[model samples]
Every structure is written in C-alpha cells, then in structure tokens.
Target: MRNREETYGLIVETAYKMFAENGFDKTSLAMIAKEVGISKPAIYYYFDSKEKLIDFLFDEICKEIMDQYAFTVEDLTVNNFEQYLLTIGFQMIEEQEKDVHFNKIFNEYILLATRKERYMKQLNKIQKGYFESFSMLMNHGVTIGAINQENVESKSNMLAMVIDNIGNFILTGLELDYKGIWKEAVKSVLLSVRND
Candidate 1:
C-alpha cells in the first residue's frame, strides 16, 4: 500500500500527465483516478478538486523556477557576470528542451487567463513581479559598480523578456540556434558589464 506521501506524489504526477495529454478542462479527477488505479474518493483525499490539483501543479512549476533561481544566481559576481548571463540563457534553453509538457500546460494556463479574470490578474501580477525582481538585480549591480548605470531599466527589461519567453520561443519550433541568438541578445547587457 502506498504511504500518504507516495499516494500524493503519484496523484500529482499522474494528473500532470493526464492534463498534458488532455486539455485541463477535458481531464477530470475521475479520469486521473482511473489512470492511477485509485478510487475517485482517494483522489479527493489528495486534491479536493481538479482546480486545486491544477493550482498545485502550477505552484510546483513556479517553485521549480524559484528553486532554479537560487542556484542560478547564487554565485553571481561582477567578474563572472557575462558568463552568468550565458549560463542562465543556455540553462533556460536546456530546461525548455526537456520540459515541453510543462511549457505547454503553462501556456494553457496563460490561455485560461484570457477568459478568467482571476487568472489574468494572477498572470499580470506574476509577470510584473518577474520584471521587478530582475530589475532589482540590475539596480543592485549598478549600485555595486558592476553594471553600468545607463539604461539599466531597458537592459533589465530586454533580458527579463528573453528569460521569461524562452519556453514559449522553444514551443514555436523555430530551428534557429537559440544559444547563438541569446549570445547576441545578451551582448547588449554584456556591454555594460564587460570592460577590458
């Protein structure tokens, strides 16, 4: 018999698979329970409702991004700043390459935001918070004399836009060299930090 943690993990993973294969609206809790070989009431023990399950999945995805940020920026220093940007850019590409399912489901939530005011507000808040967070880092660089003071806001915006959309860009199935293009894109930010 699965322990409580094991049952919860199975439910979440199975629900993500089902949600990715079928549209979120089309995937019901009963459907997930059937796929997991569990009773519908058992699923209710883990997730009270389908929306709550999605909320859990979405939160998990966000948690993944936040967790990555911890390690991504943990070693940030002016000396390694350019390499830092490249590392982050390339990592974004790699993650998107591997997690297309999460990307698709995330986009589905974005589409849902179009019709649902709560989701729209949440998306707006998340995007703005993302922008501000990156901008704050750029400002810190300026304060520390690592990043140039000129056009810091614009630089932050450009980099944040690229970072935020790497998943969407991958989903577009463009065959362009993302790493090379990102190298070109970060050149603008690199100029401010790089001085021989």
Candidate 2:
C-alpha cells in the first residue's frame, strides 16, 4: 500500500510538471507515464483519465497554498490579523508569483472549467473551500473584537474576493505590483471592517 501511494504521488507530481510545462490539453497520460517511468496502464489504474489526474493535482496545490498561510481561527486577534495580512498574505502572493508555470496551468484549467461541467464542479468545490477558510478567519476576528460584527458574512465575502483577485492577477501573469496591490486591498478591507 505504501509503495502504491508513493507511485501515485510520483504520477501526480509528474503530471503537474508536464501540464505546467506543456499545458493540460497538450500533456497526455502517456507522457506523464513516461516521465514517471511507469506504464500508461499504471497511470490509468491510479487516475482513470487526464481530467481526474488534473483534478487531483489541483486539489494538492490548493492544499499546499492553504497550508502556507499557517494560521487558524484562534490566531485572529487584532494584532495577529494585521501581521498575518501583511506578512503571510504577502508571502503567499509572492510564492504564487514565482510559480510561473503552475500559474499558467492554473489559468488554463480555470478557462477549461468554464466549458466543462465536471471541471466547473471541481473548481467550485475548491473555491468554496477557500471562501470558507476566509469566512472562518473573519468570524474569529469578530469574536476577538478586531472586526465589526455587522454584516460579517458580507465582509468575509469581500475579503475573500480581494484574495481571489490577487491570485487571479498573479495566475494571469499580469504585470503589476502584486504585493503592493494586495497590501492595499487587504488594508482597505480591514479598514472597512475595523472595530474602531
């Protein structure tokens, strides 16, 4: 079972690199199999299709991004929230900007999702999970008297939108001051919800 899991990991990693370099539509299961030095059948055994493989890869990447934030609801005090938004949030944007290939592949997947119901569903699930994470953080801020209690849901949604836009800008390879823009946007959201 352990060896099988390792092989599965290898397949996913190989597929991600290939898709990043060559694109999702252009990268084939056979190519991934070859890169992993496994048979195409082995790839099929783990993931029935390329779309399934991409979905798994996307989930893994999202988990990594979430993990990078390294903050929880308990960490949402006024001081901590500002520090996190400035430090960890900026770090997340910077890390994302460095992954040019992955960003390209991500944007491509988003575009493809618009045309395919399965892809759309998968994307929606990932997005909802991210939004919930932001909402949880906002709820904690309210509890700690760092944020206004009025319209917590709307404030959370707005903050989440700012984060999403920053990510989208990075993923689309927009030539702008991402960190500066992110800081400004986050500050704006925080000011809007400030308890003072």
Candidate 3:
C-alpha cells in the first residue's frame, strides 16, 4: 500500500511537470504516462482522466500556497501591515522558486480559461478571498496609522494587483528579472504608504 501511494505521487508529480511544460490543453495522458515510465493503463489507476489529473495538480498548488501563506503570516501583527504584505509576497515568490513546474502550472491557470464552470467559479472566489483577506489587514493598518484609510478597498486592490501582475510577468517569461521586479514592486508599494 505504501509503494502504491508513492507510485501515485510520482505519477501526479510527473503529470504536473508535463502539464506545466505543455499547456493544459496540449498535455495528454499518453504523454504523461510515457514521461513517467508507466503504461497508459497504469496511469489510469491513479487518475481517471487528464482533466482529473490537472484538477489534482491545481488543488495541490493552491493548498501549498495557502499553507505557506498561513505560516508566513502567523507571526505578523496588524500594526505593520505594509511590511507584512511585502513579507508575504516575497515568501510566496521564494516558495514558488523552489519548483519550476509550479510557475508553469500557475501561469497556465492565469492564462487559460477553465472549461469547467465550477472550477472557473471557484478560481474567482479564491482570488477574491485572497484580495479581501489582505484588504482587511490593510484596513487594520489604517487604524494603526500604517495605511491611508481613504479608499482603503481600492488601494488594497491596487496594491494586490501590483503583486499579482509582477508574479505573472516573472512566471511567463524567462527574460524578465523576477527578483529585481519583485523587490521593486514591494518597495514601490511601501514608499507609497510611508508616513514620510
């Protein structure tokens, strides 16, 4: 049973890599099976279909991001929301760097419209939840004099959009300087909110 579970993990990881390298639409079960050194029938033992495999990969990545975000924000206090924002963004960038396939999969999701309406709806909800969570933190910052209270939601959304766009830029193109871009965006946001 342990070996069976390990093999399943391997198949999932291999399929994730293949899907990352190739877009979701282009990745086929046969291709993933070949890459994993398994017969197509063996692949079926793990995932019923290519769509299911993709869904599993998407769920895995989102779970990882949320877990990492939770850990990163665990010690954060509301007084320094700007710092926390930068810390969380940079931590996400760091975690993302550890896996190239993760970026590919993430980029694919941002670029591709899901054929499954439920997944598409869930995606929007997840994105909005993240934005709202950060905005609430920023609102706390207002009470503590860390952020401007005026138009808090709009400003929070704008700040979050900067991070999101920078992430997309880094993941989609190798020519871009990801580290520098991430740092610059964080710095820019901090400067905008600084009491000075």
In lDDT terms, which candidate is top? 1
Model 2 alpha-carbon miss at residue 136, Å: 2.1
Ranking by lDDT: 1, 2, 3
Candidate 2: tens digits of C-alpha lDDT, residues 60-164: 766675575445666467777866766756877777777766677777778878888876887687777777877777778778767777877887787667766
Off by over 4 Å in 1: 68-75, 192-196
- Candidate 3 lDDT tens digits, 88-145: 7776666666666776787677665455675676678667776876676667666666
lDDT of 1 by residue, 71-183 (tens): 34455677776777788779878888887677778888888889888778766766777777778777766766678888999998998788667667787777768888788
* Candidate 2 lowest-lDDT run of ten: 66-75
Q: lDDT (CA) for every model shown?
A: 0.78, 0.75, 0.70
Q: How many clashes (backbone N, Cα, C below 3 Å) per candidate?
A: 0, 0, 0
RMSD of each: 2.6, 3.8, 3.2
Tell me how far the alpha carbon of residue 170 in candidate 1 is from the true structure, in angstroms, after superposition: 1.2
- Any idea what lDDT model 1 has? 0.78
Q: Could you tell me every candidate's TM-score relative to the true structure?
A: 0.85, 0.73, 0.80
Q: Which candidate would rank higher by lDDT, 2 or 3?
A: 2
**TM-score of model 1 relative to the true fold?**
0.85
